[model samples]
Target: MAQSTEAIFIPHHVDEAFEVSYAEAAPDFGPLARDRIPVRSMAAGDLVALVEIDSRITGRKRVKYFERKLQDALSESDVRVSLVAELDGVAVGFIMARVDLGEFGRVDTTAVLDTIGVHPDYQHRGVGQALISQLLMNLGTLRVENLRTEVDWNDRVLLGYLDRCGFRPSQQLCFDRSLG
Candidate 1:
């Protein structure tokens, strides 16, 4: 597929600017499951459902966080990627990421996964995997080279899931200092 060289503005709080283009859907990877779960690009109306899914998974409401993240992603459609998995037209899982080019002086284009959540009822039902698989397909359409995310070191469940998804320790180390 031919690529376009349009500039994208990722928010300064996360990273700098980059050239981006809307991705076209890649070839289907066969049916993702016996029970078909539809995953698609997030629409603005998905906000409430997304927040509800996350809240159910975490056992707490985080309306503002999701609101801001969704707004940012929708505002910068060329660079940010947001996807939701639905069963019978109800959202059960979601993943949000933004494409970064040369972030921190690196040249390769990377997708920084900001957040992903699967409702507890939907866990182990391939919803999360389906969401990820579709995200990867979409990223390939945009020519993104890698997918990066941060997870708490002690969160073994998430780590195992990522491992199964083919994630390994990245060459770049993350540093942090507590502000007291």
Candidate 2:
């Protein structure tokens, strides 16, 4: 067999040859499942469901705690920001938050996310994101500039989820003192 040399030429286009175009299907910025899930302000009727969801996650029922939170969320705030994610017309997840006009003499308005819970069956779905998205929208409309939450350092799963949802460490340091 005779040895032969072959040169393959590939075609290239100049920048001017074509107009800049975007992809027909837009990039996946984030999950759209959150939009499909129905997120709405928590109603007085949602307390039972909220307590059930929390009990499932924490292995204990805190009816009194949820009762107090729901009361404050519904009655104390002029605008309700706490939300529940519903699927099949049942509450599957909830985020309890409150708008603080000022804390420690800071004049800026901020939202304190006291608690969030999603049924185990709904975990890893967009239920949590939906609650957060609705909460953010509600807070934004109220002119609240910040949302803050505290998670135990040991709870890595919750930490990772919040991190994915764009939460970062705050500049303020929290302290606690024993009253006993």
Candidate 3:
């Protein structure tokens, strides 16, 4: 018997937005079992799982921060995109980002990757990559031309991951100052 699958493509209303959902047969990832991994659009109820994942990775709780970000992302779907990866029905990874129609007067759309986290136990098992891949796919459907992320210079692991995911240094520089 053949297996059944479904794909959904959701359309965004913003300018140049593309459809971002489709159904497909189950993917065979060679030795990497694909059936156990699932990525989907993030919902408001996923906040608790996101917070737990971030807490496990950072060794501290920042519930308020995630609450605000999640609320913003959920409330603004046209400009924001967020995804979650699940393993056996439990969220193991997530990526959050938003689309900027123009920055610094440039007319091209750009995606800003705000936060990504993977539970430590799932770090090297393709959870993070799965989350990012879904994000990129969604952004592509939205006709976003570029993706940007900022990382502390000391974060070698994240930098390496971003590099492996095809992110390169941009010509523009990022400047920041503490209000305090």
Which one wins on lDDT? Answer: 2
Best by TM-score: 2
Cα lDDT over the full model 1: 0.79
Candidate 3, which segments miss by more than 4 Å at Cα?
1-36, 178-180
Candidate lDDT values, in order: 0.79, 0.82, 0.78
Winner on lDDT between 2 and 3 is: 2
Give the alpha carbon lDDT tens digit for every residue of 64-142 in model 2.
9999999999999877788899999989999999989997989998899999999999998888877877777667668
lDDT of 1 by residue, 1-180 (tens): 123455555555753455443332223223454236788888889889988988887888898998898998899656758888898878899999888886777899888888899989989988887888788777888888888899999999999999877788987788999998
Per-model C-alpha RMSD: 13.7, 12.1, 11.8
By how many angstroms RMSD does model 3 differ from the true structure?
Answer: 11.8
Better of 2 and 3 by TM-score: 2
- On a 0 to 1 TM-score scale, where does candidate 2 land against the true structure? 0.81
Lowest lDDT 10-residue stretch of candidate 3: 26-35
> Which window of ten consecutive residues has the lowest lDDT sum in model 1?
21-30
Candidate 3, residue 153: how far the Cα is off, in Å? 0.6
